[model samples]
Target: MNAASLLHLLQFASPALPIGGYSYSQGLEAAIEEGLVTDADSARAWIVCYLDEVVARWDAPVLWRLMSAFAAHDAGTIAQWGGCFLASRDTAELRAESVQMGYSLSRLIAELGVADTRALGEDVTLPLAFACAVDGLAIPHEEALLAMVFAWVENQVLVCVKSVPLGQVAGQRLLLSLRPEIERAVELARRLPDDELSNWAPGLSMLSMRHEVQHGRLYRS
Candidate 1:
């Protein structure tokens, strides 16, 4: 990847990118409320399963395919994938969280005058918008995929730390241990087909649904 593309990937993946990632725990809050994740070990397990089965099996591959579609300037494919992404989320809060973040990121990209902004438009999901931004910047597929997955893991780790109250050191350690899983996810993403993208995290989805009406909550989803 060129330096510009690399920089774009870094910026997109940054926690400070202002995508409101901190506001949504991606169901971690509900998991904690239900005691599914209470301590470092349980948190690590939850994250691992989530990244491997949920994220890898679902979002990563969808994002990768969306990147290809964006690179081709295929609005139809983007919209189809966007619908699938929206449908995959089993809760209203989760859907709102993703669309809001995506819309915000698209606006940011437009204001920044990033390439292919016209193709990206204002209505896009967070992951699809992210893929479009990086692909538009001409980042190599492998590097972009890896960076996105890493950012996702980092974000989930931060959420776990806050929700489960894991120590900073423990959180970092959990992230370190996920390196192999990250590599696996990247590899799986590369091989996944566009037609076979699906997510099956019933437990996580259930928590997200339950969280929408949760009497007391610290995170949005």
Candidate 2:
């Protein structure tokens, strides 16, 4: 990647990007409420499991395919995979979270003249929108995927720190420990074939579904 693409990649992956990632736990808040994650140790386990199971096996592969589609300007393939990703959301809140953030980033890309999101149509999954931005910014796929997973790790750690009331230092420790797993997840995503892609996280799915009715929640999913 050139300096410009590298800078754009960093900007896209930064937590400061206004996509409302801080507002959602992606099921972690519910897990914490249910006592599944209570400390830095448990939080680390929860996040690692998510990375190994869902993100490596499902999200990254879908993101890879979407990026390829965007690079090829294959609109039909983009829609196909985007719909699959949206449908894979295990709960209404999860689905809505994807769509809401997707819309936010989509609009941001359009307004900034970064990408033509109109071709993505009315409904956009986060991965699809991100893929669009990566194409527009001329970011290399490998590095973009790495930043994407790392950004997710950072956001999940933030969620744990806030909701579990863990210290910021503990959160930082969690991020440090998760580096290898993040890299491994991205590597797995790179080689994962389409037939083998799966999002079979019943535990997470159940927690997300129950989160919809949780009495008082800090996150949308």
Candidate 3:
């Protein structure tokens, strides 16, 4: 709405934002290593499954609840949401990745002089802290959700570029192809019932767990 809110949303959503997002592959590297995502078609399918089942069904709804809690200034609810987010992470790498990025982003927001930043005092979960900071900064729910999903997609595409060795054009095209899916993810996120917030991407989670023990690794996760 306001210029500051718009700027905050853009800052949060930008692929170039310094949240250490590029360092983690979200288990895509393991998927690639296992030959599960060896080509453009496979990459697209893997990404679609991740978005539709894992993120849309699991992470997005938690983020929405975090945003709601932040908007309401409910510290207790926010803490509960953070616990839930942590529990949802099935692997050590996945858990560490989320917390690391969240800590970095929360520190970044504090340095940027966003008000009420201390609410995310220390060691907050990535999605919860992110949702809280942006919502605390007065960004509307729709804009915050859009930014969150956009960031998620951008990070995934970046992973695809490296794992699949896709050219920039190809990566952009793949990203373009995801617009419809992104819209659906956003819509599904908005309508998700509180009781149904669970990520069922067993393959993705297993890949992440395996990646932790992977030899000759190319990614942190």
Candidate 4:
């Protein structure tokens, strides 16, 4: 990637991008409450599964499709994959999180003259909005996917640290261990077809639903 593209990716992936990622754990907090992720090891395991089963298999591939569609200026494909992304969310909380992040990023991009989400309507999924921004910024597909996964890894690790009460080192350790996996996930995501995109995470889905009703909550999803 060129320096300009690299800088755009960095800014888009930064934790301070203000897309409200820190507000949701995507069921991590509920897992902690249920004693499923009590320490660093358990937290790491859960993150790996989520990254592989949920994120890599579903979002990353969808993101790849969205990036391609955006590059081609195919609005129909963009909307199709965007709907697929939102529909894959198992619970209301999960769906809302994606929508909210999508709206935020899309609005920001529009305001900055990057991409016009108005034509795409308001209920954009995060993957599409993010992909649109990268496409608008002329970021390469591979780098954009890496940036997206890296952002997710960073956000989820911080979630574990705050919700599971893991140490800073533990969080950093999890990030380190997931680095190779992230790259592999991006590569696999690139190769995946629309039919191969799966959202099979019953455990995560159950946790997400349980979290919506759980008394003590630390996250939005």
Task: Give the Cα lDDT of each candidate.
Answer: 0.82, 0.92, 0.83, 0.86
Supply candidate 4's per-residue lDDT for 70.
85
- Predicted structure with the largest TM-score when compared to the true one: 2
Error of model 1, residue 182, in angstroms: 0.7
Residue-wise lDDT of candidate 1 within 151-203, one digit each (tens)?
A: 88898889888778888999999999999999998898779776655687787
Q: What TM-score would you give candidate 4 relative to the actual structure?
A: 0.97
TM-score of each: 0.93, 0.98, 0.94, 0.97
Question: All candidates: CA RMSD in angstroms?
Answer: 1.7, 0.9, 1.4, 1.1
Clashes of 4: 0
- Per-residue lDDT of model 2, residues 1-221, tens digit only: 79999999999998898988888999999999999999889999999999999999999999999999989989899989999999898788888899999999999999999988888887788999999999999999999999999999999999998999799898898899998999999999999988999999998989989898998887888
lDDT of 3: 0.83
Give the winner by lDDT: 1 or 2.
Answer: 2
**Deviation of model 2 at 79, angstroms:** 1.5
Query: Of models 3 and 4, which has the larger lDDT?
Result: 4
lDDT of 3 at 110: 78
Task: State in Å the error of residue 136, model 4.
Answer: 0.9
Mark the 10 consecutive residues where model 1 has the least summed lDDT: 115-124
